[model samples]
Target: MARTTTPLTNTQVKQSKPTDKRQKLSDGGGLQLWISPNGSKSWMLDYIHPITKKRLSMSFGIYPAVSLADARKKRAEAKELIANGIDPKEHREDQSRLQELTNSHTLQTVASDWFEIKKSKVAETTSKSLWRNFDKHLFPKLGHRPIDKFNPKRSSALKLSFDIGI
Candidate 1:
């Protein structure tokens, strides 16, 4: 028979004190609060990786900052991802990288990089004129937008220019 664990309460969590050895307080469902000998407390979840069939531990965050309720919520979400055969850690990392890329690759930033290469291959005066045209006409309208958000069909300036053969 499998042993059952009693769910932890907020009062019990708050009353827990650090000991000479590291202590883990279980809240059931693999959610635990670890109290280090140094008196730092943090939330952790132990789960078996769906693919590797190996046990893995994932940290949620520190105590007080991450309340008992919040830690439980994150545990539920992590379990849900595992049920879908996705590694929560990898998903989190991919999300962070995507956000960084999205923030860095705005339309003006990409255009500036393209212009730098164009400058090396074209005449200085030709490059200057072309850049000036874009700086004045395009940058003001859509330069702040991310590259992924740009739509040629939605841009009136691009549509008008294209329609008139510019």
Candidate 2:
């Protein structure tokens, strides 16, 4: 494999003692820095389950493939989720769901599409009346207003009651 950016010197690997515990390379938290016999440094993080006390580790990917800063960020997120009694994997799923929902749409886009679909079924006279009423009354009052609003927008001269507000 190509060399990673984890900062291990070939000579330094020969001088270090080995222990069962994972070693921290820098003062930075959660980065378990290890020097191999061939002088390659690898990083890992261990997380223990609170209820079961079982230890598990998830890679943030290899050093150069996943930079130190990004690995630390991943670690922090994992820790926060764990602290909240949430599984990091589940938290990741939730984040993905939020992103998908956020990417989907605006109310206006959906409403306009529905309007187009419904418009095709109407008679010309009815359509004309709809357009006239809509443009002169409905469109002016409601078109540019917040799409989230269910209540009709009221101009000063005409006030109409609504079942709900936006």
Per-residue CA lDDT of candidate 1, range 90-134, in tens? Answer: 777899999999988987898899888879988889889878888
Candidate 2 lDDT over 88-155, as tens digits, reads 75567798897666544433454456557756887777656655655676555555544444433544
lDDT winner: 1
How big is the RMSD of model 1? Answer: 3.9
lDDT of 2: 0.56
Residue 129, candidate 1: how far off, in angstroms?
8.1
Model 2 clashing-pair count: 0
Looking at model 1, the pairs that clash are none
The Cα error of candidate 1 at residue 110, in Å, is 1.4
- Per-candidate TM-scores read 0.71, 0.41
